[model samples]
Every structure is written in structure tokens, then in C-alpha cells.
Target: MKPLVWIVALAVLSYSTISGMVGHDHHVLIIAGATDGYLSPCGCVKPMSGGLRRRVTAIKQLSVPNMTTVIETGGFVKDSGRQDQMKAEAIAETMKLVKVAAINYGLEEARLGAGMAASLDRLSGEALVATGLGGGAIPVKKFKVSGPFLIGGIDPRIEQIGAALGSKLEPIDESVRALTDEAKESKLVPVLMTRGDLESAEAIAKKHPSLRLIVCSVKSSPYDAPRRVGDTLIVTPGEHAKYVVRIEWDGQAFTAYRFFDLGPEYADDKQAQEVYTAYLARVTSEDLLSMVPRSETDVFAGSAACAPCHAAEQRVWKASAHSKALATLEKEGHDRDPDCTGCHVVGLRSVNGFRSRAITPNLTDVGCESCHGPSKLHAMNPTKHKLAKVGKESCMPCHNTEHSPTFDFDAYWAKIKH
Candidate 1:
């Protein structure tokens, strides 16, 4: 009887595994609004969540045996310029590798301008599903993810102060209605993707109850399970590449939906790591950041110039890690790198700030100017350039959560205080 029971249990377990494999023969990953850049896990600080390497690794793991298609819902990278352009390129290439079925061009991509978007579209090949950029205004994109599975993106029009960074704003209601109608004609399971707030998403659902799944983009929040809204389901995988959301289809309804957290536990994919490392190398090599001309008003005054006025503070600064910020980068051979040099040195990106160790040796390191703002004027009139506030707002430029996750203003201030 005991032997029979053991055999029955084994059979049940085997059957379960087989059933799972069969059910998940075709898998689709919905990544929404990460605001993840190409060379991320920014700052390389420990306990970091996601990066390109981990994202690639997770995609590779999911692609085994099962047919996988990754649909990215934009907000690709935050911030702009040459570095952002490079990061977009990286995202396009990685999408090619992981076979990204579609991309809902988020605001970040739009900000790259139309010329760059067309270039990336050419690069993505067959992977870039649909032109999320519709006639005049556009929602992200709505594309076919093989079989009858379809994914669509919904993004608000950006026409406020910095409208040039965005495309024309199409009425959301009309766009969603049209896309859903198109998908329904082909008998496709249209899934809506968004990088907006919950209120906007709910409004869309209210208007178009036909959309059963809505993948959302969030900033600095934990992954939320699918929440039912009328007949539609809204879910977010959180920001950054911190998590990848997977949903399995049984040819009817979604059988399983789970998020794979990409943390330090997983080993990095060598190729993706090379991509990120190469980006780091390029930023350092090209010295692109140095091109940003500093203003005349914000001039750098050497840290030494301020030493006499605040002797005790200078002493504390000299003793603190901020004192040798450049040397730390130098040890890693990134001292000359713009990304490194900018934060490590005083006024590196400002008026008359550190240019290089050779050009502005006096300005190198997190000098008093870094915290107190550029002070060429202060040297002439010490009382005029007094800081208004020296709190979180002041330090976060470099000491942000991306750079120092463990940072606490009170505790850190205590250590470096005069």
C-alpha cells in the first residue's frame, strides 16, 4: 500500500510539470514603463535591482523550449542627450536579442526626436511590432505578438512646457477605440499597455471595456498583481528593469502571471554586461558631457580658496570621502570619464567647473563648491554667496538613491558635519 501511494504521488507530480510545460508553450512577457536605461543598475551601488545583464538573463531563461515574445511599454530611459541616444540604441539591440515583439514608444523615446525613432525602427527589424506613433497624435503601439495575442500601448500627449520632446497628442479615447477595433477584427486578444497614472488608465478602461489586460508603468514602486477594473485587468512591473512580468496562455485565458525579480542573485549575461560596459567606455572616451558649456554666473572657486573662511568645515571635508571622490574613480581608471568626473569634481558641468585633472586640479574632488554651488563671486564677496539651504535637495544631485541607496541625510550629514 505504501509503495502504491508513493508511485501515485510521483505520477501526479510528473503530470503537473508536463501540464505546466504544455500550457506555457507560448509565453509573452509584458514590460511596462521601467524608465530603465541601457547601462543601468546605475551607480553600481550594491543591493541594486535591475540592469541590462539581468534582464537579458531572465529573457534567455524564459525563452527555453517555450516561444517567447517581449513587449516593452516604453518610458525606456529617463533624461536625454547623447548618452540617452546611446542607451536607446542599446535598448533596440537588446530587444533584437530577446525578440521584443513590440515597443509602445513612451515619452522618453519620443523625446529622442523623430529622426532617432525612425533609425531605431530600422534597427529593431521584425521585432518592433507596430508604430505606436499614430497619425498626428499616438498612443504607444499596438502590435501582434504571434498567434492571436496582441499588445497595445497607451501614453498621454506631452504638450506642456517641453512639448518638442514629445509627438503630437492624439485624443486617447479615439486612439484606444481604433486600435481595439482593429485587433478585434483579427480575433486577437488586445492587451493595453500604459506609462500613465491609474486615474487615466481607469478612464480608458471605462471607455473601452473590451481591453482585458492593461500593463502599466510605475516609478519607484513595488510590483502589483493584476487588479480587476470592470472587465479589464491593470498591472505594473514597477520601474527600472527591477522586474520582468510574465503571463502564460492556455489558448483561452491567461493561466499564470508572475514577476521574476532580477537582483544580485542572478548572474549577469556576458553580452549584456559588455553592452553596458561599452557604454561606460564610450561616455568616458567621447567626453561628450564636457561639451555642455558652463554659464558665466556659476563659476568654480577652488576649494582651497574657501579653506581660510571655514577652517573647521574644510578640515572635516578633507577627512570625509567627498574629499577624495576623484581618486576613487581614478583607482577604477574612470577618473577622466565624464560620468565619473562630473559628480566627483566641483562644478564639473557648471561655469568654470573642473574640466580635467590637468586643466583644473584645484577644482577636482567634491570640493566646497560642489555642495555650496559655484563661488567665483564668493571669493570676491564672501558674504554674498551664502547658501540658502543645504539639505536633501543640495546633495541628491550625486548622492541620489541611484548612487547611494543607503544614504540618509541626517546620518551622512553627521559624519561630514563641521
Candidate 2:
């Protein structure tokens, strides 16, 4: 009887190993939405979630494979002091560190105007490639990876649509058809990360049955219902703003698993205030001045001038949320308003030439003093006088209800690459 039992156990083990009968045996991890510099303050709540450090830790722990492919849907661009170039630089650095597979450019990528966007693509390291479905495709050196995985990027618009009647309709059919053809020829699944609506995506998927997954970014919709059209899977990140979806292919079929924690929603009262207060203390006026080198007496040199002397600090500031604030405001059209211009501009009303009205200096753009308060006192002393240092309280003035939907420091910080 003991010999018979042993034989049966051996047979069972053999079957499990050969057949791959375990349901969850193939493990794959997919992480998305590290918007980084694009974050804003949610009501009174300070940023509590998302940053590169935490993200790196999370990825390190999950390094074991069945397989893992991390994809960012979009929104990697944000106005960082001079331009949106810093956002791309920061993203490239982070991707290099985290080893992300591919990224689709969001609508914000176009915010740096057309020329700057091209420059950003050039700056990102060779490991990452930027591809699009239509004429906007930028060629990158091919990267070799093992397994039956295919990563492709698609730009949302086919033709540039200016404000005009009947301009609403553009020819995206050809682009989708081309992408589908490419996928079928390569025997690889096609994933789309775009700013288009679900309805538009469903329409496109209808024509291209080979496109398996359509991951929508830029829109916040409910997640309970993941629309399936033909053989494609349509999903949006929803309220759990950032999410991870794991796709496993076993030489036969593909299965997906999604994991996300949106953190907490912004509350109007005390908790929000406390979080804001804490975040502000982290960066103050004195802190900003300290970041500038004492050797550089020209305080008006802007962010680029400070970069050479304080390489490490400049790297950190380049990745910070404050740097991108002006660009975000401008993109959102808040730059036109006086109320918003003050905070978004370096020195709005001060004699230190920090105001947006200083066109000759080109200080209208977001700069160091935007978060550090006025630099007048710090400039006067250079070394002796200390301006107000930023603290959690300092961040609240801008990060509160006036700016973002919800702010999680940890989540926001996790997205920053530098």
C-alpha cells in the first residue's frame, strides 16, 4: 500500500509539472501611470503617493519572472522651469533605472511645442524607443528582448485638427489598418496608449481585430466595466489613477491581471490641511537659494544657470513637482489669469524681478522662487541672510484645492525619476 501511494504521488507531480496545470503559474507584472512632474495639489491634500524611489523598490521585489513588462500609458511631459525638456530627461533616467519596456507619448508630449518634443526624444537613452502609428513616428535603435512579447506605440491624432467645422473628422482608419497589419506580420500583440475616448478606440478596434489591448490614458473613467470589442481588451485606469496589469502568454493564450491603489481621495477639511502643511515644509525660500551656488552672483540666470554649479540639487529640482507647475498652468490656460500667474511665476509682484511681467528676462516662465517665496532677501545676502525655507506649509499655498483632484506625496514622488 505504501509503494502504491508513492507511485500515485509521483504521477501527480509529473502531470502538474508537464501540463502547467496550475492556474496562476505564469506570473507577469504590468505597471503604468508614473505621470511624474505633471502632478498638482489635490484640494488641501499634499502629494502622498507615486515617486521613483517607491516604484523602484516595488519593481525590485517583483523581479522574479514568469515575465514582467512595465508600460507607461502617457503624460510624461510637464513644464520644468525652462521647458518640458526636463520631464523627458527625468523620465528617461527613471526608465533606465527601472527597466521599463515601452512608453506611448501622451497629448502633453506635444506641449513643449513641436521642436522641443523632438529634442526630448533624442535625449532619452538608447534602451527606450518612441514609436507612433502615423507620420509622427520617430525611429529608435531596436532593443532585443526574449519571449513572445510585442510593444507598439500609437499617436492619437491622424491629422492636426484646427478649430473648424467639418474638421472633426480625420482619417485615422489608414493608421489603424497599418498598425494591425504590422501586428499580424510580426505575430505580436498590439497595445495602444492614447488620449482618444473609449468610443473612438472601440471603433478602431472593430476594424483591426488583431489589436489585442487598448490601454487608454488621459481620461478618468470608471473601471468596473472593461469593454471588449471583438478580440480586443479596452481598459482605462479610472479612479485608482495608477495601475499595474500583468499579461501572461503561455504559447497558446494570454491572460491579464491588474493591481492598483489610487490612495485616498482629497478631503476638504483638516486631514487635507495637515498633509499640505507637511509637504510645504520640504521646500522653502531659503532652500531654493541654498541650491544656487554662492560663486554664481548673478541670481537672474534662471534654472539653467544654477544647473552647472549644483548638479545634484539641479537633478533633484529637475524632477520636482514645482518645476513643472508653470507649464501645467500654461497648458491648462491658467497663465492668462492674474490670480494663478503669481504662484506659477517666479516673482509676480516683487522688485527682485521675479514677476511674470518681466518679459526681457523671460522670467514669465516658472522658476526657482515660485516655490521658495520671493528671493529678494536671499539675493541681498547671498550667504548671510536666509529667506523663508519651504516646509509642508509652504507647499499648501499652491497644492491645495485650487490645483489638483487628489495629491498623494508618495505616489507623486514615486513617479519622479531624478
Candidate 3:
């Protein structure tokens, strides 16, 4: 009886010790990634999700004071150019304001070259992390809130832009091995940030089980829950700044995880709005609207030109929102912005397109020729130069999923039917 009693007491003691070891040092992790040049909602669509302003608000609201740590998974902009460089810089500034701990140097960042990359790192408060690549990016970033938490970033397509990167690229597997080994040696929890799909991230996770968390850009819908590959947790911040993932860690493992959509509920942060306003001011000051590469079009005979023969059609269009497109931008103070003007006005993408309300007053707004095709010649000849038939495909250029998520051809056409 005494031996059995001792065995039971020892089992209870071991259980209590194990429970004590799993400490409850609560910490919050706020992650944003795969922004892809969407600094803010295009404003063409109402109640839109995504924007740097809303992101700041979301992070501020969700953050847990000193316990919270912010990080970005890169893919900040979709393309490379002067505008993209400006966007990257603006993103870096916003990240610095949030005190983001680390940011992954993804393919887009690499394309910007070492000079721009280094500049961005400085703008981001020196939070850039790159494991396999170079250029003002640290191989690993260490955080010491609960303890030492090490994070490393890898761009899987390193070889694709190796020359542009201006540094010898290490293999992805080698980079992961180094990060994991260092974490093990230093007794720190390891996190990896990667740009690509979840499958590739999971493959890396399976190879390096020591990686505790992998924040990846899934490039699609945000995952509702973290997917587990072995003992490691794989998560995503979603694409295009539409969502951010929050993870609550209790030292040993994640206690709570959620993907918060940056919807209308998250109001725009004032500082972030200031950053965005400054960006717009740059766009306007630089006259980027004129710099846009224009395609050569035969003619754009404005909406009024059609009113002579097709008075009813012109009336339908005037009654619809298309005619008032420029007004919307005017109200928002984005009337001069190239990004918005291209969609709001006619011929902005053509040499003969709308230049300004002063230069081409006739071309302002979504004109008759916008959907029906440029028709100065057609208006003159009438019978010989017939107008091409317009269809639902005509609207798709601006009415894409990102701009008009609720667009229905039937419903919309009904409203503007001639």
C-alpha cells in the first residue's frame, strides 16, 4: 500500500512540473504582408477593404502594449518602377511608425536593387530581414519580449533575380538550416517569413521542423486557422493588405489565432492618412498623370458628340454614375491622381485621351467612346465607320473583382440601358 501511494504521488508531481514549465507569458504578434502596391482602397468602390491607414488602425487596436510585436512578410509592391519605389518608401515609413520588428525582403524588394533596398531598410527603422539574400537586410532579427525570438526571411525565387540582388544568393534549404541551428544553439524560438504559396512554405516547414512559426503570403483568401505541418504552425497575413493575422503566444505555443479583415470596421488611422496624403501630393506634384505611357488611339469623340444622334443613349449615360465618375474623384481630392483618373475619365490611357478638365473638357468622365471604342471617324462617316458592339467584357477593364466585387452585368446594364 505504501509503494502504490508513493507511485501516485510521483505521477502527480511530474504532471504539475510539466504544467509549470509551459509558462503563460502572453504576447501578441501582428503580421501584414503581400501588400502588392495597394497602399489604399482605390475609392472607385465603396466600403472597400485594405489601405495603409486601416492597417495602422487595426494594428493599434489589436496590439497588446509592450507584448505586441509587428512584422511584415514583404511583397510590398506588385511591380518595379519610380512609383513602386515611392510606394515601398511610404510603406517603410508607415511600418516604422508602428515599430515593426522585422520585414521579409521578398522578390519585389530584390528587384528594387541594393540601393533602394538599403534605403527602405533605413526607412523601416532597420527592420528588414533577409536570410538567403543581401542588401541592408539582416539574416536574422531577434526579439526579446518573452525571451529571444529569432525571425528570418527567404525569397524562394532568389536565383531569378540574383544579379539584380547584387549579392551571392544562398540556397533556401541552407538558409533555413542556419536559422534553425542558430535558434537551437541560442535557445530561441524560430520564425520564418516567406513569399509564395502555402505549399512551398509547408515543404520548408517539413524539412525544418525546428521552425516554430512560418508567416507566408498565401496569395489568395486568408486562412481562418493556422495549418500545422509537423509541430510547426503555418500562417498567412493574406494578400494585398486586405487582412492581417494575429497570434497570441503563451511561451510554449499559440493560444489564440485569427485573421482580421481590414474592413470598414477598422477606421483609418490619422497618421497613416497623413502618410497617404503626402504620397498623393507627390503623385500630383510630379504630374505622374502625364507621364503614363499612352497607347495611340484613332479618336475619342467625347460623350457630347454622341448626343446628336443618340440622345436617349446619352440621357441613360448621364443618369448613370459613369458620367459623374470624375466628380467622385473631385470630391475625394484625387481628381489629378493618375491611378484613379485612368478609370474615372476617358482616353487617359491613349495619346488622344483626357489630359485635364482645362485641356480636354470634352473627354472628362467615362465618355461615350470609353465602352463603344474611340469614334471620331465613326461620327463623321456614320455608315462607313460603324461602331463596334459593346458587351459585358467592355466593363471588365474597370469592374474587376478588386474594384467592383458586387458587379453584376445584368443588374448594372439594366440601370444604364438605353
Q: Give the runs in model 3 whose Cα sits over 4 Å from its true position.
A: 1-24, 134-147
Q: Rank the candidates by TM-score, best first.
A: 3, 1, 2
| CA lDDT of each prediction against the hidden true structure | 0.67, 0.48, 0.80
- How displaced is residue 175 in candidate 1, in Å? 3.2
Indicate which candidate wins on lDDT. 3
**Whole-model lDDT, candidate 3?**
0.80
In candidate 1, which residue pairs get closer than 3 Å at backbone N, Cα or C atoms, i.e. clash?
34-240, 132-140, 132-141
> Ranking under lDDT, best-scoring first?
3, 1, 2
Instruction: Tell me the TM-score of each prediction against the true structure.
Output: 0.77, 0.52, 0.89
| Candidate 1 residue lDDT tens string, 1-418 | 6743543454345334533474434555445337466345644486566777777776666553445557777666777788788777777766666767777766677778767767666655534332244543332234555545677665675453127544455566766776688778978777777767776777778888888777766665544466677867777777776777766655666645666666665578887777666766777788875776676656777889888888998899999998898888877656655555778888865667788878888898889878778777878786886655666778888887668878889998999987
Question: How does candidate 2 fare on TM-score?
Answer: 0.52
Instruction: Name the candidate that leads on TM-score.
Output: 3
Indicate the worst ten consecutive residues by lDDT in candidate 1. 131-140
